[model samples]
Target: MPKLNYETVRYGDDPQVGASNAKQIFLLEELLRAIALQGYSFTTVTPLTHQRFLLGFDGLAKNTRDIFGWNLPFKATILPPYIFKIMTEADLLFNGGDCFRSKIRISSLGEDLFLHSHFPTNDSHAVFFGPDTYRFARFVRHSLRLFQLQSGFADRSIPIRVLDVGCGSGAGGIAVIRSLPIHQLYELNLNDLNFAALEYARVCANVAGIPVNVLHGDFFNIKNSQFDLIVSNPPYLNDPAARLYRDGGSLLGLELSLRIARHALGLLAPGGRFLLYTGMAITSDDNNPLLSELLPYLANDKFQWTYDEIDPDIFGEELKQSNYQNANRIAAVGLTVMRIT
Candidate 1:
């Protein structure tokens, strides 16, 4: 996939111009800050829900939420002058006939805003944020609390090391680090195969005031490294398009999740924890093959873990696809595994 270039983006056949790299990144952050000052907030929903919202809605944007959150095209006058200028200079706007559409969407998670690919994220490498991101962040926060309470790691002097695999928009790492107590020293590592995602993650982390180390490769590429807390919210849908941000490979979309689990589990330091949030394709017989496959690993005496179905059914609209023909439902699930040895 062609890396999304903030410095020189070609929006259709408009112009061959863009802001300088430093200026573009700074301007993008400024744009987000400006929106934050306005108390703007938008929670991204499933793609189906988003599509439904735009259906029969041909109205122009009335506010920042419409343009940034709802991903609607708007007349230039609708946006504050600075926001408009920043977006244009940063190559973040798509000129649509009579109005402009933001090439990026900002979603609010807790008090922080994250930049992701625009709505109807059909692009293969589109960075995505939705209900699953929210759930994953909550799961991380909750697991962190439990880790602190049960393991006494918070009171120790050892600096905590954290990693977020397939870190789309760096939401998982950002949320985990933000939820950590001020006194706790920690390092955050974010890895993703999508360069576009890494760029977006970098911007989001900068906006959140969180320092992060971005690894621009698959998690398996990081060798001889272990983390105290590793969290991931990987793509878990059996998208027919096989988009990088959607498809989870074969086996009802659980194959990638299983692969990540196997790899991340090995990178857990002693007393470290691995937190995962993904969808499980449940067959008509009500069996979760993903969990069943993971049991042998979690059954080890040296590790302790917990699993939960966060939601019984999600993405019901996907059932019509042949990829999920054997799936009766897609269940949102969470797994937290801690190494005791």
Candidate 2:
């Protein structure tokens, strides 16, 4: 993959960059508001499914969902005048010789909207949001509900410190913050290696009215003492293109997931909980490489953990790749580890 030229900034503090980012986010939020006013809603599917769906439709867009969610090419006249003006102002409208396309896609998670890269995300820094994102959000919400039921969980008044590792689009952290009780205080921290992802995350956070501290770096970049809750949904595919959002290194793409689990354990405070949602390659022999490696780490008395298969088979199409030749299927798995010393 080509190296991403990202200016390593903390919170995008530079005046010029901050101003430009502010304008871009403002326009994106405006666009999202306009879309919601029109009651537009769409759920993003896998890239393959999206392509298959597009094949059944005319290449041109017919509605807000078609133009923005399906990422179809549309003529300038297809959009309402106000929507067109916002896209133009935001510089998100791309001109083709005969048609116009959107530079980004907005996806819906219930009432919340998130901005991400357009379809066919072939770019090295594409911010991805799809089925995995939805699963991750659900896992976070479920975990928070369960956490609230724990003894003494409702008594403490101190704010919970939460972190989301490799928080693309800040979905996991944002979902956790959103699901919390209104009286419960929280400090949300999100970190990602992709600069473009961080930008979208910031915009998503702003639109949701959730305050967040964004960290830009590779895995394990944010140096904090500990967190009351940590969550992640990392990439687990062996992409030939080596896209940061898709490649999960070696070990049948479970390497990054394992590494994240280890790092999260060390940063979890006493009584803290870590929730991970990722894909695990299950071999023909029924061996799960990820759980095997993670079991040893949770053997200590201070930790209690549970692993559940969220989906028995996902990305079945990936079997065609030589990298996954030894694997029978990719399973979506969720791991929850609670520190209880």
Candidate 3:
């Protein structure tokens, strides 16, 4: 499969990325949000463990925890009748002859539960949330705190606008909004090419009661739109599947990161800022080409920037691939850029 090019993703409707499925996911998200209020939380794991946990349960979710946490099939008797009825009404409680399953998975970030695509997210429109989501959320929180202290909100009349470009599960934008004080007025714009992702994003925003303006298209497809803050945790690997959420395209999986950074610079509202969390490939020659490519844009006086490597080595498993044969390591990094007039 060819690597995904973010700039080229088409908008408009497609049959496969159906609305009915999105409605089903919304219902599922509502149900899971209720469960979340009951002190239910599941920290999702990698795909290997996701399968293994369900395998131990005979490939079926024997209880509520198993159902939400492992993405396993479940028998009708495993859940409360009302909850089962809700799932059934959503048209998602599928019966595979012997057992039933849901099309979405509910996981937690802190006490906040989220509905996302099921495990083994091999689909092109998969919306994923995991360890990286948690880290990205932290970075967002940190940035907000820094902004609050530095900017001092002296002018309450000024509107705060944010864009989560390439938002995949809406976690980044929603989490940032939720972290803000309730009295603050803000508008979050979530932009993504995947209809499924936008649907999930809407549901998440609804669950949080946060106002949002969702755009279904590539980054900045709206042209004149600008934001006070732009954030993303873009795909940063050369995934063989070319899954929309995993492949970052050429430059050793740094292409999308570079594109987003450059494009975002032009879309910021003067004092606007960008927080990008992505992984970088370190070659055998110990060169950081990704950073090198971005420096020219960041080096100018028009911007204030900082780069940090949060994880020096990640996805070590990907090294087995020929594309990564020359890579010495893969690191998760965060880049914060502020546009100054």
Evaluated with TM-score, which candidate comes out highest?
2
**Model 1 steric clash pairs:** none
Model 2: per-residue lDDT, tens digit, 80-104?
A: 8999999999999789987899999
lDDT for model 3, please.
0.77
Model 3, 1-341: lDDT tens digits are 11123232222244554576656656766686767666777888877666666666665666667787777778888777777788888765667897887777877775567778867788887988888898899988887787778764313566677888888889999878866766677777778888778877777777767767766777745556567788999998988778898899997799998998888888787888889999989885457776789888888889998888888888888899999988889998899988887
Q: What is the C-alpha RMSD of each candidate to the true structure, in Å?
A: 5.5, 4.1, 4.9
In candidate 3, which residue ranges exceed 4 Å CA deviation?
A: 1-26, 55-59, 152-154, 284-286
Best-fitting candidate, scored by lDDT? 2
lDDT-wise, the better of 2 and 3 is: 2
lDDT of 1 by residue, 1-341 (tens): 11211121222222322345456667778988899999989989888778899996889889998998899989999888888988988889899878999999999998899999998888999998999899889988888877777745664466788888999889999989888888788888778888778777877888888877766666766666778888988888877788999889888788899999988898888888889999988886557687789898888798988899888988898888887787788889999898999
User: Can you tell me which runs of candidate 1 are displaced by over 4 Å?
Assistant: 1-20, 284-286
Q: How many pairs of residues collide in model 1?
A: 0
Q: lDDT rank, highest first?
A: 2, 1, 3
**If scored against the real structure, what TM-score would every candidate get?**
0.91, 0.93, 0.89
TM-score comparison, 2 vs 3, better candidate: 2
